[model samples]
Target chain A: MGASGKRPGGRSARVRDAVRQATLGELAEHGYAGLTVERVAERSGVHKTTVYRRWGSVEGLISDALELARDEPWPIPDTGTIQGDLRGIVQLVRSGFADPELGPVSSAFVAAAVQSPEAARALHEFFVARHDQSAEVVRRAIARGDLPDVVDVREVIRVAVAPVYYRLFVAHEPVTEQDADRAADAALAAARAGVL
Target chain B: MGASGKRPGGRSARVRDAVRQATLGELAEHGYAGLTVERVAERSGVHKTTVYRRWGSVEGLISDALELARDEPWPIPDTGTIQGDLRGIVQLVRSGFADPELGPVSSAFVAAAVQSPEAARALHEFFVARHDQSAEVVRRAIARGDLPDVVDVREVIRVAVAPVYYRLFVAHEPVTEQDADRAADAALAAARAGVL
Candidate 1:
């Protein structure tokens, strides 16, 4: 967080937005290793101390940036069936990968989280928030008897997402819409069979 | 490569092993950002040039390390069924996660591959090799009529592995033998349903 570039209505909020944008850019170009508070401050046109005061560490800065980005509208669509909801979630996650900026920033945080317990903790909370929010559509479908109530909804969420993340991190493959549809069908079929 | 604390067979090779080990230790503590070539040289008591000559880059070093680790005996057990081979593959991957040093290094390489194309290439080759190897076991099973000849063994490999990698990276959970068994079951069930 630094000096606001916008006309002052809420100066600090604007500065926060600037800082977040700068952080994402830095991460995309330089990765977690090269991302520094000083660089973020300079890029955001804010004082170095201001960035440090707000974020405390590069990890903290990244976590805040991710939190800010999370506010962007990526709602789970209220599709009538479990398969439909899963397709929507896959599309939403896939969009993150399409962005040259956000994709690497997300990966940077993911990389950082592996070695840092604090980062891991922050990431876990971030995932729980997103998963819980996105899982509502699936829960609704189960409640409406569109899906079997016997299947654990949480497992369904994980099953649907497991492949997307696998492609993202391990397979190094893009999560295509076709892939999402296949995953949705597979997950729903498993759930229907009381396997998921 | 650095100073060898072990029996001297080949000086450079010993130094390389030492440096590699030092790098692994550093990676466990520091992740990619904290790991430095100088530190590896110091830790191993070898010249930095030796490391650079051997690996060229940290990503290269890690790739070699993973490949070396993979060279250790890990076989897909034969129980005269596709399910047995699947279970073996899962267990083998699960065992890799059990290693304190190798596990973090493996995860770090996985996380880094998300950004670096070189790392991604190495990771991709690893997966392709694994899929081919595991699919051979399934192929034999199909020949024996344990599974339908129509099943795509490659997709079965993905299903078997997607869950293991998901647990390791995405879920940040340990992969138990039971979890492996479940994934095997999931793959077989999907294959039987003509989805995989």
Candidate 2:
């Protein structure tokens, strides 16, 4: 944008970013139920017809937002040890949902997915990307001779994070920092035991 | 009815039972979004006014259904060993979701709870009861010297069941029976490692 200076392609990308930001804002404030294309158009300053034509619907907006989120590089910890790395990953998950600004938006995604099959598929893909990225830590552990070469790296990531999700989403329970660390530790122990 | 001689209290109980059954049936077929007092009343053959008077809203109906479900006894397996017992419990959790009829109804509760705080509280209480009941097996394991007596029994139960729930509700991944067994085994491993 700085180099191109208002070219047609730059304008298109600006419009998409505007719409995605507005979508996250709306989801954060009003949740999936309160999101409307008209409101998003107003908030984003994109023309109503353009939003309608491009996004098609609220689900489309959510899916696009999720897709963009998935593409962003995550800060997977390179803490020099698998235990620290795993704990860092799980702690990041816990804190993400505890953030005042970010928590509602993340929860909004989960809330939306449960109600819509299309949204659920989008979320599934999002997790697929996330799991793949986060699995690198376990690979590092294997390379360092800390874990067996045959460990299911992705499964380790899942087990490490699953309890946090379960407590927050399924059981509606509060997740402390200790809870998150324990979850990571448990997954590591399981991996060490060859149970994962 | 015969034993109670159609007393007013007995009739009221019957009405409640019918409404509860209808609520479950509606939730199974159409999920939380499709549930309505009118539909529940019509399905139960109770007056619409009565349903509204008692249930108040869809969330209220959901809470009541969850309460009733909580009171129902779960088949807590006593397989004479913690390994088999933990496996049985996780398998039960996995299969309950995989069951054609029960799955949707159960999922509806989770769906509704995410959207409504009242339903979330009810779901929370429901899990409290379930955790208490399911923790008995862990206690038995401690008694039989199968586990350390000081272990956090409820945490073990939580960790065991969490991955299954995470696969289904959070990541939208398919949880195989082997996955269930592995989750249980992981929890056991964590417990033995004194991490839980």
What is the DockQ score of candidate 2, to 2 decimals?
0.84
> Model 2, B102: alpha-carbon shift in Å?
0.2
**Prediction 2 TM-score vs. true:** 0.96
- Residue by residue across A7-27, what tens digits does model 2's lDDT show? 758878989999999999999
User: Any idea what lDDT model 2 has?
Assistant: 0.94
Please report the candidate that would top DockQ against the real structure.
2
| Model 1 CA deviation exceeding 4 Å by range | A1-12, A28-30, A70-73, B1-34, B39-47, B69-73, B171-180
lDDT of 1 at A48: 92
Rate residue A39 of model 2 by lDDT: 96
Candidate 1 chain A TM-score vs. reference chain A: 0.83
**Model 1, span A1-196: residue lDDT tens:** 3354455757877788899889888989998778889999999998999988878988788778767655665677876766677878877777776678777778787776765566666776677667677778778987898877776676667666677778778977767777766666666666676676
- Name the lDDT value of residue A109 in candidate 1: 79
